[model samples]
Target chain A: MELRGKELNKSIATRKKEVLENTSILSEICQFLELKDVARMRSVSKIMNVIIKDSQFIWKPILQRTFPEVRILDHLTWQSLKNVYKSLRDYHYLTFEPHSSYTVGIIGSLGKLKPYPDIHSPEIESSGIFGGYSNYLLGKHIISISVLSIPSIKSIRKLRAEIQCWILQVNGQAQGWENVLDEHVTNFKMNQIKSSQILIVINSDQEYKTDFILDLEKKFKIVILKYIDNKTFENLTKAILKICRNDGETERKVYEKQLIRTNIDENSVQETNDSNNCILS
Target chain B: MFYNFNKIEEVKIRLRSAEGHICEVEESAALMSSFIRSMIEGFNEVTEVSLPNINSVVIEKVIEYMRHYKDKDPPIIKKPIISSKMEENTSAWDAGFIDADWNMVVDLMTAADYLMMIPLRDLCCAKMACKFKGRSIDELRAEYHIENEFPSEMEENLEFQHPWRLE
Candidate 1:
């Protein structure tokens, strides 16, 4: 009886090995794994690593099944699908603290704003900006720039900020920066900021008047001021303006037309409405 | 030449397992397997189908599944199963049906694949995936009896190339 039990155990072990070694069966099994799990599975053995890395068959079905609305565009190669899967899994959140009275103008490839479901802190108001059109661009990519009224160190500690947005990429290129400024401005208007004084604060370290800033100065009334906090703002604004020059002309036209309308309807209290008043706070 | 529905339902198909054990199942239940259905179609009078790769134990389990799902379709198991527990990811019946030892699940998966029973194959695959879900590389290797074939340098390089691992 003991020998019979040993034989059965041997058969079970053999069957387990057989199932694991079979590439087709292994691949089918992988289709139900999360992206991170699949990545971890690659380290198991040479056969598993090859089965995962060599083809898109395993990844494609998982991607399609998980995100049915997201279409895999023609330009994306099979090799990049794994990376795409990883990016989709990584949810991007924008966190900042705004002063009580300061209305923050967020500009980026943002869709309609909805409350972020994950945060439970009542002190913090978190909104997730769904990038509807940009979802077609690439895997829910978002780049967000937040314009905050200079916060007192006390208010910064008091209020917690978490904003989510999609950053767009096309053909593995960082295309979110292109024509994003105009979209940012449009989204700002949609948020209904009635402030006549628009502040364009640059960080203390960055060169004061980049051509992009100069171009922005041409469109809005000019004041250049320094901000001490958050070095990320400098890099983000520079990146946005650096790419904003070439294709920005068309968007600039549409923005100028909107600006004229906003000045007339929203900021009627200000007497001189030649260009929207921008004060560097 | 009209056939009575009750008569067709009364037909029994005999399945011969690898261990030469014969199991009888309703014709309608047996036809759930595309492999058996094709065999029956090819030879109209074929009442017994041979499954050489599947053992008697696994074949009996497959027959149970076929009998339960004879008149209806199995609930679809969603891809990238959200939970590690099979019960949370699928119907209670499916979860209970698949609640077996790892060896049994593997054998059932192999049998389902051989029999061309896609729903059963997918259910088994999902159950297997549940074992793999949220497990670390070392854990996976240990559980599956896989030897780490990569050298230290190659493993490091592979880790560096992993997009998700960097973060």
Candidate 2:
């Protein structure tokens, strides 16, 4: 059965590759890639280059997936997919807070928009560039302020420590996290967080363990919840995650694996699950 | 998926997949595929439907979804919104169902496309789009097993092509 599965996969893959390369199926699969990446893949061969250049159908799925609420009958000279991706990200930056996450202590509210009281109305201090806004809020008012708590920060530290430990072990007497970062710990001494240096750090450490990205994401999420409000957190989070982001969306992918965990009625996606309606994660 | 027939045996439809694996599914479950629905409507009460393009593996997985959603329609994914409730896994069973390997998913997508099952196709595509999020060009090539046949000049100037990504 295993051999049969392998053969079927192999034969089908080869056949599909042929059909895709020869027919318009490559264009179909190219539809799945971002426009810039499509252009990048076009670099592969003249056949692909011609297929991508001639391909006018990429925006169809992009429009369908990005803007489901509106029906655009007319053709559009689409802006770059990166622009569309950025604009679509505006959807993820909703002010609404999930009632379930609000109810449970799992997520501290940065002040719910409506349908819930803004108990403390979180005193948010803005970080101009990185949007890494963090202002300390008092006891009972923490939920209204931010999800960042002493415990969460402590956990963030622990997460960073674990990574540093792993990096140290992997380096094996070479420069450690401290030596690499020039002994700065609490905050990054430099703002080169998204630099290729960090990318190298992420890629090198990721092979040792799968959770490296997930762990980075966990810390990133914790860091954002500190002074989060709409695009502030998401913008910063995206930048942070862009450095070390893997296929893992941290909690979402893992919980999704334990199927049957989600029972909430997701039926309203067609009618009212608009960007404004959903609470930001 | 069985209920008491009270003396009369339950009526079942046979699905002959590409590999000749025959699966017995209820009529209602089989009707989830619009193609099958039309076929059933047009034809005389035939007991079997042969799907030439979809294999047994794809059939088995598709049937699993059809069986589960026979009664309730799967949620339509209109836009790309990752829910806050994704942590609890409440109500989004279709996402979990379509979580197969790359080859299986592509095949299932092909089968779904052939069957004209828009919901399943959308789910598969949306899931694929979700994976596409935040992936680098190198990563995309690696995962998709596509070749980079860029001429040296284009390769040298690739970063210049997408200046935004370089940002």
Residue B167 lDDT in model 1?
Answer: 29
Any idea what lDDT model 1 has? 0.58
lDDT of 2 by residue, A122-159 (tens): 22112110111211111211111112211122232323
The positional error of residue A249 in candidate 1, measured at the CA in angstroms, is 15
Instruction: Please write out the lDDT profile of model 2 over residues B1-167, one tens digit for every residue.
Output: 98666977656889899889898888888888888889888998888989989899888898898899899987765444343122222245766676666677777878888888877776666655555444565665565466776767876666565554532
Candidate 1 lDDT tens digits, A1-281: 99999998787767777776777887899888876787777777887777776646766666657665343322234345654555555642221123111123232221222222332334333233221110221224422233322112222323323322111111112244224434433433454422122233332322334455457656443322233223223322322322232234555445444444443454342223334322122
How many residue-pair clashes does candidate 2 contain?
11
lDDT of 1 at B144: 66
Evaluated at residue B54, the lDDT of candidate 1 is 88
